[model samples]
Target: MAFKIGVYGSNIVESERALGLARELGQALAAHGCIVITGACSGMPYAVAKTAFEHGAEVWGFTPALNLDEHRRAYPQDDIGIYRRLIYVPPSYHDLFGLTPATAEQDWGARLKYRNVISTVNSDAGIIISGGWGTLNEFTNLIYEGKPIGILIGSGGLADELPVWYPRLRKKTASPVLFEGNPTRLLSLILQRLE
Candidate 1:
C-alpha cells in the first residue's frame, strides 16, 4: 500500500511563498509515490492536492459536508476532481449527532473537527504548511496519535509557530517531527522516518 500523507494548512492562503511551497510539496509527494490526503478545502491544501493529482498521485480528501451535494453547495470554490476519492462523514454519524443540512451551516466548526479527526487518523503521517486554527487542530490530532509529522518552516502561520508549541504539546508517544524550510528535503526527512 502507498504511504498516506496528510497535507494540513491554511484554507485561505494569500502568500505566494506558501503557495509555491505547497505546490512543491505536492509534486514531491507524487514523485515519492505517496498518497496525498487533504481536508478538501481551498487554499494551501487545495494547491497540494491539485498538483499531486496532476502528477499522477492518488489524492484523497476528507470533506466537511455530509454528501456531494452539500459539498458543492457549501464549497463551490473547491475543485472536486482533484481528489481520487472524497470521504464524507457518514450520514448516520451526522444523524446520531442531529447534524442535518438545516443545522450544518451553524455547526460547521463541529463538522470540520470531525472531518479533521477522520483525515488525521487515516494518514500514516502528515505535513503542515502555512496554517491557522483548523490546521492546529489537525496537528494536535497527529501529535495525540503519535504520527510522524513534517513541518515546512518559514511557510508562516502554524508552521512557524509550532516550534514554540511543540515542546509543550508533544506527548510521550509522539513520533519524530521534522522541521525544514525546503519542501523536498522536508519530505525526504519524513519518508526516512516512515521507512
Candidate 2:
C-alpha cells in the first residue's frame, strides 16, 4: 500500500488559484498511488475528487451527512463519477472526543464533528487547501492530533489566513502541516510527510 492523503477544504466557494492547486495536488496524489479523501462536498475538495476519479485512482469521500439520503439532497450536483466511491460517516467526524459545536443543541453536532475526525483518521496525511470555518475546524483537529499534514498555501482562502493561525497553534500541532506552492510540490510534501 502506498498512502492515503485526505484533502480537506471548503466547498462551492473557491478562487481560481486555490482550485488549480487543488486539482494539481489531487492529480499528483492519485499518480503517487495514494487514495484521496474529502468531505464529499463541493469546491476544492470536489475538484480534487473529480481529478482523482478522472485519473482512474481510488477516492474515498468521508461524508458528514447522516446518510445517502442527505448526501444526495444536499449535494444535488455531486459528480456521479466520484460519488460512488464515498464512505458515508454520519453526524460529525469529530464526535469521538466531543470537539463539535452545539449547533443543533440536540444530537446532530456529534455526527458532523465525528465525521471530521473520521476523515482525518482515515488519511495517512492531509492537505489543507483554502477554506472557511468548517475547513478551519478540520485543519485544527488534525493538527492537534499530530497527523502528518500539508497545506496548499499562498493563493488565499485559508492559505492566506494561515500565517496568523499557524503561529498561534504551532505548538499544539502534534505534527507539522507542511506548506508548499503548486500541486506537484504540495503533493510531494504531503507524500514526504506520510513517508
Candidate 3:
C-alpha cells in the first residue's frame, strides 16, 4: 500500500507564496508515491488535494458531513469533489460514541474533533502548514498518537508557531516530528521517514 500523508492546514490561506507552497508540497507528495489525505476542507488542503489528484495520486478525505447535502451545508466553501474517497463521520456519530450530543443544535465542534481523529488515525504521517484552530487540533492529535508529522514553517499560523512551542511542551516520543521552511526539503524529509 502507498504511504498516506495527511496535509493539515488552514482553509483560508491567501498569500501567493503560501498557496504555491501547498501546491508544491502536494505535487511532491504525489511524485514520491504517497497517497494524500486531508480534512476535506477548502483552501490550502484543497489546493494540495487537487494537485495531488491531478498528479495521479489517490486523495482520501475525512468529511464532516453524513451526506452530500449535509456536506454542502457544512462546508459550502470547500471543494468536496477533489477527494477520491471520503469517509463521512456525521454529527450524530459523536453522540452515539459518547463524544457529543445529537440535538437539533448539534455539537459541530465535537463532530470536527471526531473527524480530525479519524483523519489522523488512518494516515501514516501528517504535514502541518499555515493553519488555524482546526490545524492545531489535528497536530495535537497526531502528536499524542505518536504519528510522524512534518511542520512547514514560514507558512505562518500554527505551522510557524509549533517550532517555538513544541519544545516547550516537553513531550517525548519515538515518532519523528520535523520542521522545515522549505517545501521541497520538507517533502523530502517526510518521504524519507515514511520510506
TM for every model, in the order presented, reads 0.93, 0.85, 0.91
Q: For residues 23-126, what per-residue lDDT tens digits would candidate 3 score against the true structure?
A: 89888888887889988888788888888888888999888777778878877876666688988886468557765366745666666778899999998899
- Decide which is better by TM-score, 1 or 3: 1
Which candidate number would show the highest TM-score if scored against the true structure?
A: 1
- Mark the regions of model 3 whose C-alpha exceeds 4 Å error after superposition: 90-92, 99-106
Q: Which stretches of candidate 2 lie above 4 Å from their native place?
A: 90-109
Each prediction's whole-model lDDT (CA):
0.89, 0.74, 0.84
Better of 1 and 3 by lDDT: 1
Task: Report model 2's TM-score to 2 decimal places.
Answer: 0.85
In terms of lDDT, the poorest run of 10 residues in model 2 is 89-98
Per-candidate clashes come to 0, 18, 0
Best by lDDT: 1
Which pairs in model 1 have colliding backbones? Answer: none
lDDT of 1 by residue, 1-195 (tens): 689999999998759899899889989999999999999998898998899999999999999888999889877987898888999978677667776555745667778999999999999999999899999999889988989999999999999998888878636866788899999999999988888
